[model samples]
Target: MPPTATPESSFSETAVFGDPVAQQLLPLTNGRFAIQTVHGFAIYDEADLMTVAQSIPVEPPGWPNSTLSASAEHLVWRDKNGRLFVQRLADEATLDEAILLEVPGNPNGWDHPSFHLSPQGNFGWLFDGEAYSDEPPVVTLYRLQDGAELVQFRGGLPQFTSDEAFFVRDTAEGLLIYDTTRLTEPLYTVPRDEEISIWDIDLTADWLQITKYLRAEKRPFVELRDVATGELLHTHVMADDETRVTPSPDGQSLAVTFKQDDGADSPTVVAAGVRLYTVSGELRHEFLAPQISPVPIPSACAGVWTSRRSDPVYSLVSVDFAPDGRSLNVTYNDYVATPVTHLYATDSGEKLAEFTGHESLFVANGRSFISLSTDGLVQQWDTATPDATPQTIARYGTPITDLALSNNGELAALVNETGAELRRTADGELIQQYAGATAVTFDPDDQTIVLGFVDGRIQWRSLADDSLLSEMSDYAAPIRRLAYWPNQPEPTVLALAENDCRVTRWQLATGRQLEPLHTILTFDEYGDVIQMSIDDFTLSPTGNLLAGRSWFMYGFGVWDLSNDSNILTELEDQPLGVRDLAFSADGRLLATGEAWPLGGWVGPERGGLRLWQIDEDNVSLRWSTELDQFVGAVAFSNNSSLLAVGYSSGDVTLVNTHLEQFVGRLETVSGVTGLAFAADGRLLAATTRDGLTHIWQTGSP
Candidate 1:
């Protein structure tokens, strides 16, 4: 099937940073510039002032980059709130005035706004259109004015699914929405005839760009398009192992970065690099840095940091770019107790600052340190100097079982050796402590804390005074996990009990059981109940379903409680010794991790993930991939398109569900024990058996 052609803006050629070649130098406007870093957006004002736009927390399984674009009057970005944010980038502006326009019907995936900005300062968003049935592809157009939405135009584009995104452009006829999903269908009236799969699309002022790779090809090619109409855009075929692409703010240049590969699926064998091109599709310059060998820290390595203080002896792994595009800030490779690397001038590759002895720093309004010491302390540091001096903000000297941070950064709840503690973020002060607590979380209001204990009890405590408000009980064994449905008003708790492999729901403030306890205790060959997933379990975001594994059966099952006759459908052909399960936020997909013996041998050898899409009565097994070592956990991105698999071998792989292809892979700490996504969908936190947490920056989409 070929993608259909639509009338809208599109992008094709892209430039990327860290492309294993060398740092690139792009001429900036007024000698000041902006760069899209790994996580957030960065800008350097004309005065050489550097500022980070926003630090969105990564959502687990995984969340894609928030749709971001800048116009003459505002910079628009999607936050974890599942809403659109329009911030006035004009100097001296506050986010308070950054209007947040809610999407009608509360669309899922926090689907970023897809619109076009007119030179006259007018912008339009493609809203959820009216689906009257048997429609082709249609999207409603809503123009932005005075922080509100106005009906601009409608029914000029092809019909598309709500999950699909599109771009708009103004032409002689009117506004048009060009859908890229048509790429999966047959090309009828479309322009270009390349049969490549697209990873993403970007639109420039004069041209539309697409990042695509042909079937069985090593690297993706860049295709360009005309802005006012669906015209053939130029194409740039790339070499294998290409990594990143960036278009200049003025839409005149494209920077690309790629790494050389010795073999397939091998760690890139070169230094970070770059390439540049003009809007006319002409190669301008190529830069290559001296390749620095990766120094493997002791397998005792605890974590990686971008702003940490240590002896200047170890390598670090950090990527920060100067706003002027004249320099790049990089930390050495992540190593045991490494220090923060320095910012090097892109032109001369000269060091600007050497942050020694400081723990890794997370920069916000000001610099803050972050450390994972052996003593169970999670600390923050200043990035300016090597003063390894640390400030102990929070310490969990005991073994930790489970933890959760609220949607807002106001609370931290965790089950440690001393039990569950609800800590206030203001001063890292212990707000409340509960004994034998298995999991803790903050309610939607951020005023109440729900603590689930091993004794099959759940308590809701007021955050202000630590007073117990309500308690729900009636479980068979120790509760292993607790989760709440998103945006629900009442306090409904989903409890997972390991002893009997049960999933139960209880309503707070009312001693009522919302539903009967569901379990994986299905009858075996002899009609005897077999307990499964006594070790771990995961609940869908809506709390209407639960996914877990059976230890001996080596399979994962989904328990659906929305119907009269609740059913637990076990995924077919799952390997034995299944460990964990994760569902997308929408509960449309399920990802499972399992460990099994290879070559029909005895001990656990191979494992990976199996993904399933939920239909009405039957489930569609989408794809399955095998791994080298045991898979500890699996998570789906908020969009349900990508799955993050954490392996016991300290490796993480991101896979696209639709294409069933690998997106990227990275190394983590020791065997992963727990994996969580932050509310912002920007950072993924993985807790390993080594008692360390590794946070990875999911670069901008």
Candidate 2:
């Protein structure tokens, strides 16, 4: 039998729960059966355990940060928008009745809503439910009954003495509870407010648990306390935060899963590593799980849990943890918005090894290209004979944007909200700093750096001495994209405005503005021109052809540069509508990526990727291929024999032109922004959204 490609059998195990998961319950519920899987949420139904609900048709942008909560009445959760929702499994088509649970005028902002539902349908709790003391440890609590406001409180609630009362939230100072038998005050009070976050509480038994958290130390501790007598029953400190702590069916030992850090940008909390902790604060046994870390880095306190037997860490993007937590689920870097690294192991807290195989876009030598992932560092590849191992260049604190490479490829410039930094590619050292730069590029002469802003302004600086090259341009709108003609001798530049569909060409030396070329709109409603490249401004390749994407309509075509009209047939309504546009090295073909589509707005895998055999002779599509995944970027190696495709899922596939078969596959990277083939045709460089770059080489030429 052919080998089956099942999810990590052990670490990525699917636990059969009672009901189907409602993934739409963002932030509050972990979405259906399997919460937050790469493709979508794994939902389960009460009928058959193995059968799971598939992800929704639409894909969300960026890494998904979700929280899940399961209640008998409904499943709830939140998405990146911080919106709260409830999902009912009865009818799959009903998507209404979502409530915005964010409170009015909460200082903590709407992003952090302390929402928790009780399994007993008592009341829900929001905020701290205490009077605002205007201090570091002020606690306020809001009570909810049947999803409606029930009561609000300042300080601690009145203590309860009945067996039907149960605590919902706890702090060092006190505990909040649901009083089945109404009492004027059914809350218990502790002495202080600092040292604890109540993970669970049982008011009837006069028992509560304070989960201790230390961020810098990456450790999580728990203490069992007697609420009635303020007695510390037992204190247990674990190596890291416990991804899940579920009391055994008999309530003797707590099945605990410690969150281990996998070296990926964002690690998922996984099970495979399980421990049984006695309620008396005793360690019964810790199942030694396999190690999955690529390196021996300590855990950074990130983890999650599905059951007492299953614990996994969640990542920003997507990840796969192996069964035993020993072998790695081949790390797919930049596989999604933020990249996810997964470690396979049996123990939830086992150290797992991970490798990142993705690249980022950066600036070098006044040219912008994708960087290859060489080890953990970023490197740059020259288009000329680009086969060499991209020389190791700079290291960014996180990812970088608006990188400006000097003409000689010696110095680099980059920016983020914190400001901009210019560094040397050779030694990865900082050269200068600037404020508020959105776009960075090098001048054609490699003598200066250009800085574009969000406020419709552009600035330049001389590279030789880091002096101001020219006064900033006071354009009408933010410069969305900037490109310098590839082979131009003088310092000429193209500026894209965010406010309108206009491409402005400016000659730096003469300050001469040519009549805006290709300003006429092809579609009634203007389309977003994702990217624009210049080869020979004379339109020699395809007879006055200008290639780009149109707004609302994702289409790829060559337009008559003189008239701004479509030359070849246009492609429209594709999900990822022209994330990137590339002309084959021979200029006989054009490729467009289906990645970076305006997700959350549309769904229809419309050609995941398509290659048009440029009928330059007739100016039409000769032939094309239908891709399956969302293509983020595309490139044709110099010889045009191999087509490199980078996908939003971080999967990179190299396909042969003649047979259109897969030639090679690289590690999954985040959304690929740009692709550049080396001059030698043997290497490919891919740039990702995470601000890292990578170089890919193959054994076969």
Candidate 3:
């Protein structure tokens, strides 16, 4: 039997009290930009960063260049399927009728196709080609008013002049100039040596600036040529260390980045600084990279910059001029450290602003900016208010593997690539960080935490001073989950090893392992007996009952932990498999949630939420309900009055556990990863796949 798809729910929405992720930011006009998220993209005015001029509920292409292209009056973008769209930014009456055109090649291909809008917003161009291919790239020019193709040809790189009257293509033979009115042939060509590689080209009203590197001399130089006559105006040879050169929008000045060795034993060559130069080769200013420690040094040596034996060095990533060309943006990073972006005054050589932890920066204007971090967080900054917080326009959060909440609900623990982080639940402020931790859980008293590492080591640490209370290493695989045993006489915890697929109980005070519980078994395809492991488990509040789902068989079983006896094992009706389980506060009700199997393995049942009554010696299903998406997490209120089921569809459905009635639904922008109810049952915290955490106020729901 095939799985039945559930219909969407129509319940009154519950407001999210706390949301921690912001939309991503992309530069557009001089003082405007776009904010994108999983939902859609919205254009914002930078004056106050609040006015939304236009918004479209369409997902942008995966490639950054194809995401959005804006001119003074219009916006252009391509969808994943190579469909190009043009929208007017100002006129509300023309907003509904956006011009659309189907581009020829695969925009989502490995070649990374890009779209560019003309300065006047009257023309658009699309470039498509493979990076390593010998064939020339395909270029198509389109008239934006009606989505009409103006011309199509094979070109190297296209540069449009400011007036939009002419464009130039840098080809293997030379630079070919094309007139907007006459599309038949090039007006003239500026010949160049075959051995010289053109790094970048910028076209101005009267000058064509080309940055080229000579293969024989191992050097780079800039050439200024007359745009109309194809005659060389000036040739400026740069220093050998100067690797990259970028011309300002007006083509009057240039920004150059260089690298040098720092006299180390191994000859550590790093990007030393940036230099501002006139078109005629006169150096205007030089700004050097700051020498600083990547991490915090001792307090005693805080102000003493020379105390550290070795300072961090950075390699240049990119350099760009502001839209107005009065300032420059330089980005660099030590491969192993956080990247930094610095804005400097082009004329004075004075550092205007410095932003750390960003891989790239875009200047909308002299006062407005957008930055992208390595981890996918996009921020917008206003230079006028340097002391104020930057706006979080977008975030691509690191995936959270596991999550745990403190008993008092005041703190939340999460595990990711950087180990465990303790965050305050109220406002999501990071309180403490623990490195190399794989799993974490809080004690009943909420004063200490137990952490499991990848090396199978477990440690109990105090929350106040972060002192290690006890530790033990008894396993040989990564610790997957850590949970405290409820209603225990002494402090006890259960640690599950990922590869070992076995749970080990340990005494927190003595660092001793306790006796093993019941062994889980299943039958193979050939009907032979095989030992199985638990994928997920939950212990009842009284510590007398335990429920777990098998890793291989997809079945789940209930056992009496005190007597070490299996009470029941159910393998029916569960087509996919159980993902998570939770026991009610009174230990009388058990809830199980299921997730779809990996690798697109579909079954008759996509999985849902099931409520069961736990008797003295048996378990019986009280009620079950199917959801639109497979259940990802489940939690019961402290008073056992409500059950909150989080689904992969980013919807959380609350139900009256005793009445068996639907309550309300909460929504997020991504799939829910984990869910927990506060100790007082007044708040619910839900973690999502987007690395964001949302807190909802539970008001009688």
Candidate 4:
């Protein structure tokens, strides 16, 4: 019987919850700062840390310092295709249209290209070349107001003056200064000594600060020179371990991060703190904090060492002067402790305030806000009470690899490399955790939970008391998938290994192993028969049919589990790869999603979702729709009336099975990793790669 078409329904997003990976915190004008996240930039007022505006581009930019840059007025970035984007900041809109500029020449050979925004946001510069090439790198300067190239040159690193009147480029001979109005020739050249190599350069209105490494002494030093005359004013020789010299905005003082050497015969080097100094080499103050103990180092020389400091040694990640130069912001590495940002007086060295740098966002009940941060702390703020403090929920040292929701929506299973955990969905409370777990799933009754381990073992444990019910250890490879069969006499579980081409079945009730089922076989390019391994798999509702997607063969196949016979096989001859497949509830329809072979970011040439009609012995294509993004996941509704397709571009589409038309579409902040529908078909859930899980209501319009 043909499945009925799903009625027209209104899909509304309910809640989105997750922490975005924060890339960097950039200080802007007027005590304002911007947090560069994976999605885009979030500007906040530093006084109260309130969000002023959010600037998300049409296509999210790459990581900061690589392909993304921002100023107070504009944001510049590069897409995956090396096309530069310039967006203007606006007070009314969170997202603004950006002008896309396709860079000339093929960027395929470019290595580690980066973008830089001018201090005033009027210009953008792109640095592209081979990382270790002998030739000089290419630098292209663009006028931000319009996508126009002003000049293109070959230089190592380009630094723009604060006033934007002139810019300097580091070259083999010296620093070549150029007037912004005319780039025909260098205005002046600051010559360098043969033994000195520039590591970093900061240009200001009156002075130029350069960090240079002395080859003879094997030490680094900071040099302050006159910007107009190109004459060295003062030079400060840093300690053997000191680095990262950042000049103040006014170019009067400099902040240097240094490591302290323990006074032993074979001294251990540890990052002590930042040192504030004037350009004339006058020490202002030492901004020292508690340090984290360094890891034990293996050395040939041994000496008796006694510590004078009682606090653990911690490393300083970065030190930045405030826009006004009155205070300094110090950040510490978060490996040994919670990440903290400390503000200190420049002259007095008085500690002002400490912040976790975690932004507290209050989103509307049904509206979605996407964020990503590097920190592992997770907290939930009460939207009902505006001034209430947030409650800390859970802290994860490692990133979440996979997530699954129970049938009743009461429990959520999260998997990482080290273990799998079950948390209550109501308040995000941890219930149980299993170490060495790779994958996890729940039974239909929600009473028994099945877990797959990296050691090729499967455990079926009771959810009520967290007791082991059954265990199987037949395979020698890591288990990747664990699913329970429905409508079976015994509670049977199927397990797929990461390196095997067969699926092993185990009966949980009697703890007995069933016969393994092999996937389809196909002919290779050399005309030899080869067994295709499944990269993704799905089972029919009745457990009588199974579908497997072969990533290597760029095809998918269906097999009759009752007879262990391959019933249908389809292969694409192009460079398209089948990503996911799902079987309808009635076992009469199948849906498969495909995408380009090269990560799906290379222009949308080929990829989409296809629906196939499955008969007793034959399968026919019902309809196919081409998409602009890679399809990451697909699932069928409980009644097989609606098919939900998820894409790498964070788009989720609901399609009517019988009509072959789209019912609704939803967008997320990142690529969708998993998709599922509730048993009653009233709710749909989608998990994104950025650690966010979104839930939506499926109801009549």
Candidate 5:
């Protein structure tokens, strides 16, 4: 059965970025820029030189941009999971995300594609740069000139050649060229008898170049097709056993290299030749291999890693004539760790100092170009001046996964591999930083912050003064959570292990362990008194009851927090699938959810919720409702009137506890990981594993 459709939420919306790190930056009109993070996008005005102001959050978290817009009033980006999204600049009020496409589970076929935004930003070219080995390649051509989609299709990226007449697509049928003016119909189609595999495809200003190996003929071939009509202009084939073909940037010359089998049974290049051709396939000039000193990675520019020496580690391979055909460039084609491109004089064999990167180069001009390195550093190179040293625009900050500029371009926010930071953009100076933090909790006064690191390091800091107060580092295990206590005189921290049942208390200012108590007393399958996992647990707002899931026992338990660390009651039924549970604000009603049962007679018929009425000695079940999918999250309203449940299938059901019936449903593509009710019972929020938080208002009308 199909899931229920979620209606439009009527509650007002405001996005929250919890220590978000910016990954990409795109400059827009009037000194405003879009700072993109793995979670969301923030538009900031750079009116002030030092202070960032009026920063507004737009789009949902987890909507990352593969490509960004500059002049057009829209944002174009693809999420890390290969979901495409486009949003108009004007409509910033609602959840109006236009989902462009979805890449399947295995996105190997849809990798490394470039987002081609038109000069005016009205149109966008959606594509995969390389062809897939299994399925037919597809692309979408979107015309968003008027902020509405004009035309889009499943094909290859649009071809905007100098002739501006045709674009090509590799459909299941075959390679077909279509008229740019009329996008729906193909003007010419390349005939094919059987299935064919293309190695590399290049569309230049005046021609279409396709490189493929024909198994029937036992040879590799490069075919040049005419742009006006998809007719084969020329076919270059290898006569020897092993050969490599490289087309020039202008699509005029084809460099052919013949290889011989060395003693190791590997192909060794012994002969090479460059064959020049005209637009009509006429042979222009042929140049053979010449002896010369090869260019290397400049001594001034150091490689990113230890393997990146001052000199070239590998030979200058894969030769291709430059656009002007005056010199030749030897570079690596595949995406390698340490990538470098060298320029050599093809005729004189003189070494040149120019070495570009593996991917696209940011060419400022014909002689000068800029490129973003594989290590996320910006590099500038000048081809005209051979002796000029390389200039690094932004020095790389290692261990930081992402970085972006603040609203006013005065500061930069970075998501560190371990934590997060705010740095000065001008000099790369560290301003404020956190160390190895996995989770953070603030005190009620908002003056103290307790941080839990993955390495089991717990520390306290003053949020008002940005000073470290105390820290502890001898937990023997990583800390999973840190909670701040408000009713204490000195700051107190409650830390829980990632998988254990003990909650350790520590003095925030002294860094001293106050006490260690086990929430659940249990023995393993061997009946030993050991640290059994409290698979799932939650405390009531009034601290009256502490409920937990007993994985090995195949049931859940309730602890009397007011008395001692003892299980006041236990319910033996369905095992805890996700350890999902919640209690009402008054502590009188408890809502517990169970996951799918393991290898047993039970199934999802038992995967549902059970309402419990808490008493002094024991708890009694009120009612239980079976759910469709395994439970992932559960929550209750502050007033104890409504119960919200989330499933592994991303389905959320709102139930009226008074009426014992489900009233509404919320559906999400990404499964829910967390759920909560606002303090005043005004907002209901749910968070996904992909970092998306959905919050809406719910109250009695």
Candidate 6:
């Protein structure tokens, strides 16, 4: 046995749960799984469970149709308007891979989209599903390399070869194979043995392996003929009553796993010894179903409690070779999808690891096999090259309701039923727990975390030891925002009152409480204080100026810190209440952004971000950039050169502050909850409403 290979000493993350209603395992590639939900498609990395590589929204352009197919790189969908969409996933800050093309057929009534793209991304095949059943199927081929539409012909079951593509179909004359690369040309026709059905046939690159189904003859027989000339190479007579032939793409090898009746009272799927043969019909190797099987295969989340029968029942789901031709992989499922996967040496037929309960076995270009268990455990086994013990990557539990990443990007706090857990983001290692925390934030130094509970209590814990540093009595309400001055010493914390008014200040070290502070207050004709809804407010980097909504003022403000004076500023002119605010690293530029309430959508023209220049004499509006969609979050890059704006459209727009222009945009699978710039300012992290934290790289300004 070889030691396991690891990219790190240990790594773990939570993957997002698929929509139980209409969840599907999208094609896996390079350790990434694209999950198709009812609303859209999401790509998840093996680690970092909810991390979305890219998400394709199914709304205006594409909806009311079915998901054609999806993989890590490509997503194909059809809309009601007879439009087929092909989206290429990307990390770039732009939507460059979205392609909307009108498919030339019935739009609304098709049962499925018959489209397939090769793994190498060089060619594509599509057939109109509606026309296929009603009339002759019209197949169209496209050259992916140049985006050129090839010839159209009538065929089914298209398979790609080395340099040519071929399709098989049943005709009056036996099974006919046509080279799609050359339209209107027939490659070969199988020689019939007394009019056998041509509907099911297997065509490899160099061999057309056709199994003759004779009802009188209990077991079917297969013939190997040249794919191009129809010349008979050899014949293989299956030993059992039933068999399935799986041929490799190269056409040089074939695997036949058999099932036969043992003349018992109850039939069992046993004696399924798989045989491997070369194109010349010589037996290369043989593998028997192992008798010493685990009670419940690892392929299933839970095992069935059926009492063991006297005779063991076994079956093979699939068999294929490793890309390098050194090893082979075989999946043995009892009856349903749960399977026990056996990896064996191709030349010697020696058993390796027996993986249980593995479904959706995907082999990547790296020679590593990725298995997803029914229990949602994602494991990556790199039998290709091993060095250490293999490890389980993640369990991919239900999506976290809320999440927060430390400003230093070192810790990610996930919300659960009990409370919140702070885990090391680097390796998903749990570091501390904040029980019953409703709101959380880290101090400027990132060493101490301040947690607010539902009962209005505030707690501080040291990150190094997970020890209680300080605990204070309840506030009027659960804390909303915890603001700290960048350069202030002895660390004073300002929190929004439970009712969303008045800022209460406290000392963290001694848990000493202080008097509440108010900047501006309005009075009615009765001389009573007026109440207002305050959504956002932020303290300046120097802890002097403030931009928020209070009782009388709702926009930008510079409060008198020493006396708590309610002096109004230019912000009094703005009518819309501020939704979010941020101060630049230099403290000279204050940015405020807001999104209008449109229920759940980031409706167009509903919100935008405004940049303000703060100076000693007066505060003036620099430029207000209009956002075409609903704003989700806004944050200024540390250098104040760029601002990251997240939207309800599941996209983040990067605007250059100095130029006041849209630089680029990044797409997400779900709406954003908050946006924060890493301390280094090179990376921007955005947390989605679905509890996924996406960290994006924004290069130098």
The residue-by-residue lDDT of candidate 1 on 1-701, one tens digit each, is: 00112211111111111101001111223332333222333333433232323332212111222333333344444432335444444446445654445342221222233443333233445544332334323344434446544444334433321222445433224334454333232222333335555565555444556677677655678766564465764667665645656555344556666555335462334444465666566776665433332322222123311112232233224354433355444444433342445544444545545544333332322243243333244444454542557555444343335757665544556565447765543444666668778777666667777777766688887877888898887763456677775545566766665444346667777846776454543435456544443345677777677666554544666667677666656544445666777888788887777776654445335665777788666667777767646777676665666666777655666776777777666554345666655455544555454433455545424
Candidate 4 displacement at residue 470 in angstroms: 2.4
lDDT by residue for model 6 (1-701), tens: 00112211111222222222223455454456665543666666765544576666665432224453323444556543345655554556244444523454334233335566654445666776542255666667776544578767665545554335555656555566777666566677655566354334775556677777666665667777777777888777766543777676666677777665577686765566678877566888877765534332112112211213323645555786655556677877664334677777766777766777665555544456655655455566777543335557545432333445567766666653345767765555666766667667677778887777756788888887778888887554455556664555677777664444456678888877677655333324357544343434677666776666542223445554554444435443463435567778777887776655333332223566778788764678888855434565678777777777776545667777776677666655555567777666655666664445665655533
Task: Give per-residue CA lDDT, model 5, range 1-701, as digits (tens).
Answer: 11353432343333322333345554454444454444344454434322333343433333234445555365565443445556555544353554343333211122445456654465666555343345434455766654444456565455555344656766556677877677667887775546346666666656888777787775667788877776788887655543566666566666654433343453443434444445345555554433332223222223211111122133234665544566665554321223455555544556665453333343333464444443344455666775587665443322332222322333434443446554443444667777655556556555556767756788777755778888887554445555554356677766765544566678877888865656553433356434344534566666556776654434566776556645687653433453477788788888877765434534322366778888888788888866545666788876787787876555577777887667667754344666766555666665553334455555433
Which residue runs of candidate 1 sit more than 4 Å off their true CA positions?
1-400, 409-412, 421-433, 486-489, 521-535, 598-604, 697-701
Which prediction has more favorable TM-score, 1 or 6?
A: 6
Q: Which run of 10 residues does model 5 get worst, by summed lDDT? A: 303-312
Superposed Cα deviation of residue 401, candidate 4 (Å)? 4.9
After superposing candidate 3 on the true structure, give the runs of residues whose Cα lies further than 4 Å from its correct spot.
1-24, 46-48, 59-66, 72-96, 103-108, 111-114, 128-135, 162-165, 204-206, 262-267, 292-311, 358-701
For each candidate, what TM-score against the reference?
0.41, 0.41, 0.56, 0.56, 0.44, 0.45
Query: Whose lDDT is higher: candidate 2's or candidate 6's?
Result: 6
lDDT, candidate 3, equals: 0.70
lDDT of each: 0.51, 0.45, 0.70, 0.67, 0.55, 0.58
Root-mean-square deviation of Cα positions for candidate 6 versus the true structure, in angstroms: 19.0
Total clashes for model 1: 69
User: Of 2 and 3, which scores higher on TM-score?
Assistant: 3
Q: Residue 209's C-alpha lDDT in candidate 2?
A: 54
Best lDDT goes to which candidate? 3
CA RMSD per model (angstroms)? 19.7, 22.7, 12.3, 12.4, 14.1, 19.0
On a 0 to 100 scale, what is the lDDT of residue 497 in model 3?
Answer: 65
lDDT per residue (tens digit) for residues 552-645 in model 2: 3334445544454434444443333556666775667766665432233443233355666655434444445555345666777667777777
In angstroms, give how far residue 50 of model 2 lies from its true place. Answer: 44
